[model samples]
Target: MAYQQPALPYADNALEPHISAKTIGFHYGKHHAAYVNNYNNLVAGTPFDSMSIEEVICATAGDAQKIGVFNNGAQAWNHSFYWNCLSANGGGKPSGELAAKIDGDFGSFDKFVEELKAAAATQFGSGWAWLVLDNGTLKVVKTGNAQTPLTSGQTPLLCVDVWEHAYYLDYQNRRPDYVAATIENLLNWTFAEENYQSAK
Candidate 1:
């Protein structure tokens, strides 16, 4: 099972106005594909080659000999999920079960936004910010380059990539602006809700 790049859930232009098509094109096409390719090559002819991408990532994550594979595989999976976390029509507050969970865990939806933004903004370097479910409780997590909550056995409900490649084209050096806009306008709460429920 060689790692294969998943197609974007929507067209590159589908996220336009918030995230430009050109940005998505390069991010998904060049950056993400390179990771997938690297993962496949690194694991070629190894036992890990037959494992699913997620399985390989989890299995090799702590093995020093497989560090490169773990990084590439996890990064490939993370990028795929991150792209799906946005939509042109997405954004706004979450509703229903996800909304209830946010209120239950974060005191209120607004507080959740504040904390999420803070996490994304203060990550200090290239990484990711995520809303993850751990034992049915929601929490904000920050991961360094290629790291993922999956490595720690948490279920990621929604995520924003803070890697420079993700926003450099559209947001330039303004990562905070990108984070604010993403949380306010491009979040796919429906997808987050689905992931939240499924994690149970």
Candidate 2:
């Protein structure tokens, strides 16, 4: 049950012009990978050694004694989900049920993008901005550091990493630019749709 950095769905360079290969190289290859490594080591030979990352996250959440394990395990799962939330063929508007749901929940897709970007841009520090299903209602939520929506019983449909490491290389101090570009060109609506369907 050792956790590993999940493979990128596309080439590191595939998201070019929007997000650079170097960013993914560092973000996915370094930071994300490090979290997985830490998670594996922390849980080794412990009762959590046999638990899935999500299970460990849920079990240890809010327990100060296992905070290290919770942080690393949550990051491992979050990064895996974050990777799938982007794609070379993604971004722009979605179609079908996802489209209808976005309209229903956020008034319109543009508004949803606005809200998502604002949340990501305003996050005080290393954290995540997410689109999640909370009690069957679509909502936007932000979690600081290694926190995740799952611990709050929300099913995350989409997420954008707001940690400096996620954008510093690509957008420098221009976090808003990075957030805007990712929303416009990198978000994988298909993946979001699948997650939404499953959550429902």
Best by lDDT: 2
**Pairs of residues at least 3 apart in sequence or in different chains that clash in candidate 2:** none
Candidate 2 accuracy as lDDT: 0.92
Alpha-carbon runs more than 4 Å astray in model 2: none
Model 1 weakest 10-residue run by lDDT:
1-10
| Full-model lDDT for every candidate | 0.90, 0.92
Return the TM-score for each candidate structure. Answer: 0.97, 0.98
Per residue, candidate 2 scores C-alpha lDDT tens digits across 1-200 of 78767789999999998888999999999999999999999999998998788999999999999999999999989999999999898888999998898899999988998899999999998999999999988898899999999999999988999999998987889999999999899899999999989888
After TM-score superposition, the amount by which residue 82's alpha carbon in candidate 1 deviates from its true location, in angstroms, is: 0.6
User: Given candidate 1, what's the lDDT at residue 184?
Assistant: 93
**Clash statistics: count for each candidate:** 0, 0
